[model samples]
Target: MNGTEPEWLLWAREIQATAQSGLAFTRDPYDRERYEALTALAARMMARCGGADETALLDAFRAEAGYATPKVDVRGAVFDAENRILMVRELVDGGRWTLPGGWADVNQTASECAVREVREETGFVVRASKLALVHDRARQNHRPAGPHSIYKLFFLCELLGGEAAGSLETAEARFFGRHELPADLSTGRTLPHQLERLFAHRADPSLPTEFD
Candidate 1:
């Protein structure tokens, strides 16, 4: 998932982020009006070029009430006894497989989010053992580019117990050898190279944490 982002999309995201921050801190009436207008402009830009619904995008943008910042997504790389990687089929992505994880929740640390996501999505009880990587989702070139910027955290988790099972968000959970990964991966959630890096880290825990 290393692809170039469309220039317009990048500019639109910048505009949206700036406007959101302005709305969060501004007190002057004129500034508020300008930021609100910028939000609408960004929504129109995305709708026209990115093929998104303007109303929905605007609503989502306005739903945030804080200084605009990249959202965090946590992914857990849980390996089995045979050194195979644990993955789950995301129901939200039409059943495409990805490492078991999701958005980092408020009031939870990165490791906590990884542990919870793995359990919720795959029914796998795990302990987050190491932080492997922190990547910018856009910089990684994840597919189906999203409006909001995101920081993705990859953690090496220890598989303690629990059997493979599906939750509301996932269809099933399974482990795959390095050479047998599924073709249809939910790239927005996990990427091939990212998984390879995780495997490398598992092989040698001395590797330093990676960041983008």
Candidate 2:
């Protein structure tokens, strides 16, 4: 984990999520008020830990104005007939290879995000088929945080055809078999188990999609 998020900030994030959960379960107005106060305290702590203005942090917290939840992260595992996995290296991750993926946008479903990310990162047009796996990243024991709160949705994608190329976000692209996983995998963004699930899906179409 980077020193960018101090222990205090991490504590505040947990407290904030807990406070939101409390609001969901509490029925009494007094209990709701207490939860709100905890949320404000969490915001203040986050502000202090992140070196942001307290007022701004509080305002941002208030912007939600209701039960809050974490964001969703989605990824795609595009495979060829040979069962080789398509991977891309992103500049943000020091050009380390990963299966293409990104955060779920406001209008895009998990499948859409998967396909979108694949195309954007690898310049490959692919259709997201069955949802292969849904992983709780926090439970996955991967990195602390890659870019945002991500619930990884790895989908089985079929190539629709596009020239393999790199963008500003991606610097390299290639295909790999199970034994050829690059040493420079972006573990912070992609985990081995997550990829393993995709490989299993590719190996067996009967495997059910596991969700959180």
Candidate 3:
């Protein structure tokens, strides 16, 4: 979710997946061409809805066909002087202490994505200083369990500026260490071990950044 890929990529994938599957079983070349047109429509939808670079749109589509998966949304791991991680009480899952972040938008850089997600969820302005880590939400061997396929992106960000304010997406915005995690955690959004790993990055800079 920390990259432009999610903005249009998900929509396009869903569309093209269905269209390509439809085209493959059909014997008529005319219908195949029509399915091809559907694929193009899907790509254009990604370009318009995602606002990504036009020239890269088809390339993005072509790149996806061979052993691909859905784009994982991005999340932010923001910490403060108290060694506590910032948490949001999300509205979608009945309010929990997950990190501040959402799906990546088309126009922003990955760092910009980290900043946007934090600000939107916590009402805190942060400057992303590091490309801390990337995580795969699907087939999460590193994580204990899984449901839907997803990828998770975590960034190490500094609190550059802002006050803690809540919005429609989040209710209460606060900072907590490992001991203070909320009981009603939105696990669909984040897992406890992922938070722990983010803290591990903060505690030891020498740890290799990871993606899985």
Best by TM-score: 1
lDDT (C-alpha, whole model) for all candidates: 0.93, 0.78, 0.72
Model 1 worst lDDT window (10 residues): 1-10
- lDDT string, candidate 1, 110-162, tens digits: 89999999999888899999999999999988998999899999999999999
Global fold similarity of model 2 (TM-score): 0.76
Provide the lDDT at 152 for model 3. Answer: 73
**How many residue pairs clash in model 3?**
4
Consecutive 10-residue window with the lowest summed lDDT within model 3: 139-148
TM-score of 1: 0.97
Report the C-alpha lDDT of model 2 over 25-85, residue by residue, as the tens digit: 7889999899889888987886666666778766766565445567777888888878989
**Each prediction's number of clashing residue pairs:** 0, 0, 4
Tell me the lDDT of candidate 2: 0.78
Name the regions of candidate 1 deviating beyond 4 angstroms. 1-3
TM-score of each: 0.97, 0.76, 0.67
Better of 1 and 2 by lDDT: 1
Candidate 2 Cα misplacement greater than 4 A, ranges: 1-11, 18-40, 43-66, 146-149
